[model samples]
Target chain A: MALKGWKELEPGVVILEPGNTIEYKSGTWRTFRPVIDMEKCIHCMICWIYCPDSCIMVKDSKLVGFDYEHCKGCGICAHECPKEAITMIEEAKAKAEEAK
Target chain B: MVEAMVKKPIVKALEGDKAVTEAIRQINPDVMAAYPVTPQTEIVMEFAELVAEGLVDTEYIRVESEHAAMSSCIGAASAGARAMTATCGPGLALMWETLWVTSGLRCPIVMAVVNRSLSAPLNILTDQTDMMGSRDSGWVQIYAENHQEVYDNFIQAVRIAEHPDVMLPIMCGHAGFVLGHTLGRVEVLPDEVVRKFVGEYKPLYSILDIEHPKTIGAYDHWDYFFEHRRQLFEAINNVLRVIPEIAQEYGKISGRYYGLVESYRLDDAEVAILIIGSGAGACREAVDAMRQKGVKAGMLKVRCFRPFPADEIVKALKGKKAVAAMDRCECFGGEGGPLFIEACSAFFNRGLPMKMIDYFYGLGGRDTVPSEFCDIFRELFQIAETDKIKPPLVRYLAVRE
Candidate 1:
């Protein structure tokens, strides 16, 4: 998105539009990404409860995957997981592996 | 601008604080939140009595402190209510942080600041230090020379602050004891006339409107902080044009006129004195006395200080041999006082080669007599005649040696 000039901004920068925070991608600040192993996963939904950014995806009351777009990858879900189904990986290593 | 006067003013002798309270009674704002402080105490006290009498349907909130007073005003104003508050000296200091917040949120809250000195020995009297300290807090500042001007300034302040081009807070400042405690004849307009004059306050955006909800006081970081502040700068500058137009409209109803700066005998004069607030009265007297002695003396009273009125001030002082900027507050460790610094910049910007000096007086409620001002004019004349500026450009006036 293009930045606004001073003339284009509103007086006092009052946000006229609600829910504008979604425009900012917090995922850009991530240093580590969380990966889940489905073979070792239990449907206890501990990761869903522990994910601070609500990045844990759920479907039909079942654990699915992670929402990477908004996740900051704090590793809270991996730390709180009871079944040891999730692991934290460095984002640089993950991107390098993907590039291969 | 000519409209037939349909209503006659009510002539009454009232104290300055009472005169302002009467104006507030006529304005009848939607909400008032204030905590008491001397000189300014009478305004809130009398207005509270009016609220008890049910003369105005305003929600008067007796807050715990000046900080809360300004905070409550911000909330009320954000919710689309006409809000007002008053304070002085330490009270103004306590609300210093919130003052920026009020202006940052663009709340058109009108406040009557009875100018008083800040405490060291804890004195209660008249000075400009209080408001001068907050001069850069992004509020439109208007100084009054007497009781009537304070009354009139408050009425005009409502329109100026709420103007769509200029959605900013305004401070109508008068000297603490000089105008706030003194009795003077103030001609007040009819209540209906004032009501009609100020009209209805239509907020551009209200937080209370659920149908079109808007967020105020949101956080802005490096990406947009500069832009938001730039808008504030533009809005305050817009007041430079809006003030004269509103003052002209106000003059049509009341027989008195106002401007950004009032010039007394500046035309065709070689020497002049620039001042603000109630001190202008003594300066005017000194100017008149100097004229009797065949001296080319004049006075420039700056009613609007925030915008600084640089162009208008330069124009007024143009072709003059010498001028002095009299300030009631000390700048301390700086080159000179705030007004002096600003006047110097104005002259320097225009490349005007006029002899200028800085005078500090009336700090901590000290009396600045007409003779003191006459002494300043005498020194200015010598500067004009010699064309040789003296050392120690900034001098203390009316202080024990």
Candidate 2:
């Protein structure tokens, strides 16, 4: 009545749970670079609300945001921001060029 | 996982995705089911075209959706035929339910999920979100950094997934735009050589036959669900046990080494950063740069993500002061990312490192340079050696308080 092992599952059907041998790079090297426009910026928490990695820093309903640590640069916040206040940029090479 | 399978070295140049197609072609799967999306769509299209040309004699199932692509392949594979499908993002998400069923059934079908972005705006771009989201499915997942590895992994994936102890559907991946669309020169071995690499499907059961009648997708009750699941667990735990045998066999056929974890600068590392997917290349370049500058940073690129390789991870980072779990997917209130959460939970039974910080980057095909990786390692080393500093919820470039 009950299937016990590989035999009972199906006639000669191999019983396996699942195992992944391949590994992905930890978040694809996120350096959150948020772009905000002060002119069109209307204070809204939509970006904050939908931050997948929650890298936004908000105070007094005004955007004084930083990439902090977990910023994956997913650009979700930038994409969702009602004010067009954020544009995601990569910090790896861009920042280097800026320092140069 | 590279091997010299072809005896005749009449090599032809091909792309990574093309190489995957060729590898699957050589494997000679019975049913090839696929849907179109970026990165991976090219590979599937190439294969579909291969079918049309009669270059490979196989039933090509052009499914309407990715979910169906995986499902139809599962049916074909369940009936004791080697089967495959390719998808990414929404396609991968569509196949989520079937992914569970295939693994639970222990069907050794092969699928490739070119990592791509999920959507609200319905962007048809690249990201690891889909595969990371389906991380729970009982499927073996592998991430390929470039074309060479993608070719090698595709060939190796079938063998590993089909192994008696590791009977699960497989999804080998690469960065969609980076590896998928990149048209670099790849060697296309003769069909004979590839044939040698992938011999035949040694299915546990025969395809729909009059003699061997049994049920698939059957009902299992509360009396023994966990027990059924435990058998799958044993298969995962024991995969490493038989992997070496397969790797050794592969080495005999092909010279490339498919290793436990590709370690770079890990010997004297105070901080070990673990990278998965194609981004490992960036991490490797970053490690080299760090080494040149006298920084004691090392890297462990995870070649396999499923089977949860806990022992391998713990052993790799055991004595290291800290480990950074870089993930492409965000984990909301949980750890910084999915890889971080999975790796953190993994250390429960081992002497895992104390400090772990997840760095997110390159969603939707953004380029991640070596310098950013170096800065991440620099920040990671400082965090590991001293009092731990909490990671900010959102870290953006130029958004410093």
Candidate 3:
């Protein structure tokens, strides 16, 4: 029955799972994948500098695009963009957060 | 923090990184130093959006490094503003030496740490090792399990840290990869509720006047410096009483109460568990399996580990014969788990024959299935029954098979 390392936190407190009410799933809408329109965009990297998640990328010294991996769909870039270039679409619309 | 707001806006599915932005929008925080990290980028981004939209009446300081992020906050807070900043693993690690000085100077600054795993090895998972390592920096730390707790902790930390009796800085961290990414139904309490919860800030030392002359953080030799440390310890001791009072007062309005350690199903159990961060979920699933098998068990979630909570902990585990300490980070050669060893020290002086087991699991997002957890508890119970105690050390799941 004993596996090895796992134990109760105290005599009764637990550091691992104890029951079936599993509520630990990351459902959709937690992600905000941003699409960058290169044409309308001025290379204003305000979003890049201000992003708390660092989900955007500036490649080869040019503002290439956004990184969906860590983007929580906060949409601050779209809101802060001067050119209206970055738009926040749901994660289901394009490549997922993990793929990047 | 909510100053004369008609009502609170609806709860939005926000990230842990975004809590600062929301708090700024609601509180209209006077000054903020914005820095970006992998997971915490959302925080600065949202605040920038608020600044751009003109939604919140606040000034945002766009800083370059994590050091500047905290530096700006320290400067702003001292100049009589509700100042804030955020960082993850490495970024937070960079804010190190400055943090100690900020608190020692008695700045009641509030900050949100998007908890991420530290690395020379480079892993971006959720772990408390970063924040845990900073526990000695004189900042009061509160750990939130979900997005709602994330929001609530920020509101409470500002008031608690700024309280006159406890003019220590506060650091409340959220599990970056989980709550940071987990969008869920978070009920936004009405402005009335929040206002009632986070009362007016009565700053004891925060004063700004061009005409007046004052001195702070002056050069002190060993004679004066030694007294400062003693005085600092006395201030911290006041927090043990102050924190509980604030939590109880906040509970009346919000209908939610948080204590130093949260206990569930531990009253009549023979075995107990301990953990912080989001790893408590794994233990919950495993405990159900043990219960079905007729193993009486419970859990004591250690949300407040710093003030040590010795009395509450002793009350929680006084009768239990075996306790399991789960840790996400190793203690190197010192003990089985880092948090485990810290909690074990509480009991060491008691001279009671309690069997404390330490397990290092779920580090770097290693898959912690419920079955694996159940096996750990079974192993701990076995050790207890046989009256055999292994060396107080860290045990890895890889060693089990």
Give the top-scoring candidate (DockQ): 1
What CAPRI-style quality would you assign to candidate 2?
incorrect
Count: clashes, candidate 3: 48
Provide the lDDT at B157 for model 3: 80
TM-scores across all candidates?
0.91, 0.76, 0.75
| Recovered native contacts, candidate 2 | 0.07
TM-score of chain B in each prediction:
0.98, 0.91, 0.92
Which candidate leads in lDDT?
1
Greater-TM-score candidate between 1 and 2: 1
lDDT tens digits, residues B120-144, model 2?
A: 7676666688888887777778788
The weakest ten consecutive residues by lDDT in model 1 chain B span B1-10
Residue-level lDDT tens digits of model 3 in B105-190:
77777888888878857888777778877888888887886777788778878778877767778888888767776675565666
Error of 3 at A46 (Å): 48
Docking class of 1: medium
**Order the candidates by DockQ, highest first — what do you get?**
1, 2, 3
Alpha-carbon lDDT, every model: 0.90, 0.73, 0.72
